[model samples]
Target: MTKINVETLTYTQLAKVFDHAILKPEQTTKDVEQGCKLAIKYDAKSVCVKPCDVKQAADILKGSSVLVGTVISFPHGNSPTTAKVAEALQAVEDGAIELDVVINIGHLKSGLYDECQKELEAIIKTCKAKRSDVIFKIIFENAYLSKDEIVQACKIAEAAGAEFVKTSTGFASSGATYDDIELMRASVSDHIQVKASGGIKSLDQVITFLQKGATRCGSSSTDKILEEFKQKNSA
Candidate 1:
């Protein structure tokens, strides 16, 4: 694998790779607005906020190129498939440009790969049909999976036509690790993008994951990470 020097990435480039996430239900509209402002200020790719705030985020980011993203099935993937699909559709209708849906972990654990695949496919199909421009990301919550299971999940995600396979939901026991990122990268063909979410708390961690093949990042600490980069570069 080619080595990536995190220190060398430009501030703008780093910003483009971040998905400023605010998943907490308690987050107020002001909090969501602050997140949108930070994303726009830094030119981040998108701001991942709760589904309820998609329209608000979209309105805040209007005329800007930043995309709005929200979660379906959220931190837990135990929601019924129909509910997940409904959430995805509703979010898009509310102006979400990206939908990150959690894969059903219990189904996967039970070896019901087909059921899991169908659920993801249903949501993907609905999103695509409703709005061809919307992007779909499937979160696998890798903390609970074995290496082989992770690989299988990626394969299923690819088969179901998800644009990205994300690791963890930040509510899981663990977050994205170098090994897990590499494993995911190796598992899927180059056509699919990999997003690293969960415990990324610093610029170094983000750079490490990007080097390991993560195309995007999901973290609530996007502002802190970008601040660190600016300070380091200024020094």
Candidate 2:
């Protein structure tokens, strides 16, 4: 991964690194609307919303540079492979160009590598069938796994043809850490990207992760972080 030079970074370049999240269970439709507007205003790379909000986000973001993204089997990866496949297809059909699916954490922790890989393949295949360009990101929920398991999850995601491997679901016990990001970057080939999510609330944190090798970050603190960047860069 190329190093990110903080001194030369632009607001547009940094904003594009964020997948602004609005996935909280209790957030209302009004919140989704407002969130989408904020994302559009910032020209964020995408707005990651709850599965149910995909269509609404898509509608509001249509024709804008921001793309619609949604999560499947989110927060928990306990759903069956068939169910996950159906969810992915629905999300894509609803105008979600990106899908972030949680891996079956239990399966990986129990040494069920084949099961995990098969599930990822099935969902990826189903989504690609609907739209060939749908981006697939496999979320590891790294807080639940050991360091070795995190490495294993990275390999599994790469093998399953996922475009990115993510750190958490943002509801986990913890989120992305510097060590985990470096380890994930080292585990995968250069073509595969890493995304750091959860608990990131400042520009300094975002820049640190980008320099460590993350291509994207999931955060709800988009306005705060970006405003802080403006204050720093404008001085």
Candidate 3:
């Protein structure tokens, strides 16, 4: 659970909870650069970029407090375990310190728990082998999942040694909801954090999620959200 009180949250405290997103397929090099700048400007925890942009994002964020994060298997999670490992290793080698990996949604929906667990384990083990400090987050893309599936996914994420279990890929039909945050937070142990991603906009939303026990959020609206916070708090 988040130890910070939302009512008394400071700007820097709130800023650290965001993983500024630059993962849109249509985004270009310019977008990644701009995103990194925004993250640095706001002192965000990290810039969650597409796998291809990890190197550039890392270069831009170097020497800054902001970390480089990338997605694996992306919005879709149909990649084979080996392929996921390869993709993750490349991103890590490119200086990504955080990896948000999509689970095999189809496999989970089909009740193939073992397959999902194995894949997650393989990716985590392979990446950690390279960088023991690399943070691993498992993305459930929760919009497509049932409540039971979400709970099960949380358990599997913990079992697979994930540091966080995220709500969505931000490419889904729906994003993080209050109920999902509550459910996920309850579903996982304290060692595993809950990250509410997708459709999270505004200062109120960020505060609400953090209050509900989420440690992080993935958002493309980093500027808007932080600007709103700044304006409100300065008043």
lDDT of each: 0.90, 0.93, 0.92
lDDT over C-alpha atoms for residue 39 of model 1: 88
- Give a tens-digit lDDT track for model 3, residues 81-171: 8899999999999999999999999999999998899899999998899899999999999999999999999999999999999999988
**Which lDDT tens digits does candidate 1 get at residues 138-195?**
8999989988899999999999999999998888789899999999999899989999
TM-scores of the candidates in the order shown: 0.96, 0.98, 0.97
> What is the lDDT, from 0 to 100, of the residue 145 in candidate 2?
99
Q: Model 1: how large is the Cα RMSD against the reference?
A: 1.2
Prediction-by-prediction clash tally: 0, 0, 0
TM-score (C-alpha) between model 3 and the true structure: 0.97
RMSD in Å for all candidates:
1.2, 0.9, 1.3
Model 2: lowest-lDDT 10 consecutive positions: 1-10
The TM-score measured for candidate 2 stands at: 0.98
Q: Which portions of model 3 miss their true places by more than 4 Å? A: 1-6
